[model samples]
Target: MRAIQITEFGGPEVLRLTELPEPAPQPGRLLIDVDSAGVNYADTHTVENSYLAASSLPMVPGAEVVGRTADGRRVVALTDNGGYAEKALAAEHLAHDVPDGVADGQALALVIQGVTAWHLLRTCARLAEGESVVVHAAAGGTGSLAVQLAKEFGAGRVIATASTEEKRALALELGADVAVDASPEDLTDRLVEANGGRKVDAVLEMTGGPVFDASLAALAPFGRLVAYGMASRVPPTPIEPARLMGRSRSVIGFWLAHCLGRPGMYHEPLDELLAMTADGRLRPLIGAVHPLSEAARAHEDLRARRTTGKLVLDVRA
Candidate 1:
């Protein structure tokens, strides 16, 4: 089987296409023949060795895949690892049959990004109706879905931020009430202004460097900010406890990988997300699709923020 492997952690160039033996099936695991694999910030983090979880070298860096099981069951899988290969292993319970009419790439999105977006709003943030929400990186994978889910969850005002006008436009099209520029330096002011000169009730913050501070500052009294990823590769500045206490605001953190530790927290929300996608109420935008051999280029585009929507590797090609 062909796979993209990173022998050492580094840049996109480190992702090398190589020939490898097919994975043998294991008990309690589904052996999947890859159709497509989702490219995510987590994959880049795994390669850079900067994620919340530690990974050893000589790794195949992909987390979500849409593929077929041994019996030809089409499924979208949450891979423990080795997702970059033509064949991979997945825990049976985490593997789900892809809903009819959902494309392989779109099915791949539901496994990680879709589930994360759902849990972030409906669970972690505890967003309420008529409340204002700010979503940073609103044009990217999770953010795009988060923007839509916020609306579906009855948020009165949805403010989306993106680095480019084109991406920002996409955010609005997905249901954000307003779209702002995502320049980290200007984030706080832009978010406040978008909410009619007041702080927002909730914020979905993933870029953990400078933007984390700005987003936290933009939250209203009793507001909640869900911190997920450090996409910028910079550790976020610590928040003062006194500051949050003063306004009764809260900062909550979520990592899908962590929730996997408590499997009980995942199933319900994941089911809701899959249903929504199946009905077309939630669409996982396909920004870029690359052949497996072009995995390096895909990583480059995502890291550079030069792509919008979900990035997927068309492994069947």
Candidate 2:
């Protein structure tokens, strides 16, 4: 099997492709003939040993894969080991059947990004119908899906923010009520203005620093802001508990890793997202697909913000 292994924590340059032996079978784990692997911004953090969970050395770096089992069932699974190889190991329970209507790359998108978008809205933020929501990085993988899912869940207004005009347009096409430049200089004002001069009720925030501060400042009374990732690699300012109480606002944190193994948390929402994709209600944007050997390039493009939507590695290539 061919895999991209990192012997030390560093940048994309550390992801080196090499031939490796296939993973031996383990109890309760199934072998997958990997077709494609999902690439996430978190993978960048994982490589640098800065993610929420610590990563071990001399290891492969992908967490989700779209592949077929020995029984010939096409499935998407969350792998505890790694997915950046021709063959990988997946827990039987973590694997879900891929609907025939979904392509391998699209199905791969749903595993991490899709599920995170769903949980951010339904679970962590507890968004209610008719609530106003703001989605940052609206053209990226989770952001794109979050934009559409907000509307699907009956949000009264969805404000999407992106760094580029093209990305803002894509967010509108995906169902955002309005799209605004994500520049931090006037972000708070723009977000409120986009919501008709009113603060938002829920926010799906990833980038930290000014983006986080601006979004937090634009929240309505009783608003909930969920922070999942810090793509900027800059931490947000610490919050004062008294300030949140005075404003009746919440600053919640969510990590998908924590949702794993919880009943009806991972699989249920994923199934819903998969069904929506099958019916054409949700579209997974596969911005770039790289061959397995070019894993470093994929990481580079993602870190540089040179690409949007879901990034995938075609292991078979």
Candidate 3:
């Protein structure tokens, strides 16, 4: 089998494409013939040795893929590692069959990013109808879906933040009431102004450091801010519990891996998400597609924030 492996923790330059013997199915896991794999910021973290948990060396860093089981059942699967290859192993429980009419790229996008987006608003933030929200990285994978899901869930106003005007345009087209350039400075003011002077009821914040502080300030009283990722690769600004108490605000954390530890936590939402996608209520964006050999470049694009939506690696290409 052909795969991309990081023999040492470093930059995109470290992701090397090489040949390896095929892996066999474990007692409880199925071996999948991967058609498409999703490249995520977490994969970059794995390469840099900076994720929530440190990665083992000589690792294949992808965490999700869309592929087929041995019998040819189309499925979306979660991988602990080893997704950047023509074949990978997936726990049967963690993999879901891809519905008819869903493309491989779309199904792969739904595995991690889609699940994250769904839980961020519906679970972590406990988003409510007619409430307002500010979604950072609004043009990216999870952010794009978050924008639409917020509207679908009945948010009164959705404020999306992106790095460039073109990305911001896509955010608006996805149902955001307003899209603004992402800035650590005055982000609260910008979102408030965009919301017609209303502070947001929820903020989907992942970038840490200065943006974390600014996002905390942007929240309305009693608002919840779900911190899911540190895409900036910086230490998060600490929160003052006393500060949150006075405003009745909360700072919450979410990790998809944590959900995997809980029994049946993902079933309902995954079903809803799949049904939504199948019926056209949801559309997972495939920002760019790369050949398996170009895995390093895929990492480069994600680390540079040069992507607009989900990035997929096609093993067949």
Candidate 4:
């Protein structure tokens, strides 16, 4: 089997596509012949040795993938590691069937991002009908899905922040009521104005650093801010404890990987999300697809923020 191996931690260049022995499933696990692998911003951090789970040298570095079980059923899995490979092992419980209506790449794109967005809106932030929500990186994998999910969850208004005009337009197309340039200066003000001078009730914040502070400021009283990723590569800064006290606002952190560790936690939401995708209410936009051998270039595209929606590795090709 061919796999992208991270022999060392540094940049996208560290990812190497090389021949490797096929992986087999252990007890309670299933072997997946990978058709596609999802590339996330976290994959970039993992390659740089900056993610929550440090990688062992010469290991594959992908989290979610679409593949087939030994029985030949099409499925997607959130694996512990080794997703950037032609073959990988997945815990049976973490695997879910890919709906017949969803294509392999689309299914793989939705599994991780869709689940994360679903949990964020439905669980952590508790988005309510008629409430306003803000989504940072609204053009990226999770953000794109989050925008649509927020609308489906009955949010009255959705404000999205993106780095480029192209990305901003993409957000609006996905149901964001308004899109703001993610420049450090005007994000909060623009978001507030877009919401008719009302602070948002919930914010799905992925970028950290400067944007974190702005997101905090843009919250309404009792607003919930859910921090999932720090794609900006900035260190977590001190948030004023008094801010939460004064405004009755709350900040919560979420990691889908951690949430999935609890038994039965992910199943219900995943089923609902998949049903939405199958029914055409929710769509996973696959922005880029790369051959397995071009994994390094794929990583570069993600790290450079040149790709939007989801990037997937086509292992079968």
State which candidate has the highest lDDT. Answer: 2
TM-scores of all predicted structures? 0.97, 0.98, 0.98, 0.97
Ranking by lDDT: 2, 3, 1, 4
Alpha-carbon runs more than 4 Å astray in model 2:
none
lDDT of 2 by residue, 1-317 (tens): 89999999999999999999999989999999999999999999999999888899989989999988999999999987588999999999999999889998898889899999999999989999999999999999999999999999999999999989999999999999999999889899999999999988999999999899999999999999999999998887889998799879999999988888899988998899999999999999999999999999999999988888999999989
Better of 1 and 3 by lDDT: 3
TM-score of 2: 0.98
Per candidate, the number of residue pairs that clash is 0, 0, 0, 0
lDDT of 1 by residue, 122-157 (tens): 888998999999988998989999999999999999
Best by TM-score: 2
Report the lDDT tens digits of candidate 4 across residue range 1-317: 88989788899888888998988558998899888999888988888889887677878888888888879999989888899998999888889998788888777767788889988998899988899999999999899999999999899999998889999999999999999988768678887898998888999998888888888898999999999998888855697888799999999999887777786668777888888888999888989999988988988888788888989898988
lDDT of all predictions: 0.88, 0.93, 0.89, 0.87
Per-residue lDDT, model 4, residue 33, is 87
* Total clashing pairs in model 4: 0
lDDT of 1: 0.88
User: Deviation in angstroms for 139 in model 4?
Assistant: 1.1
Alpha-carbon RMSD to native, per candidate: 1.2, 0.8, 1.0, 1.2
Name the lDDT value of residue 32 in candidate 3: 94
Give the worst 10-residue stretch by lDDT in candidate 3. 261-270
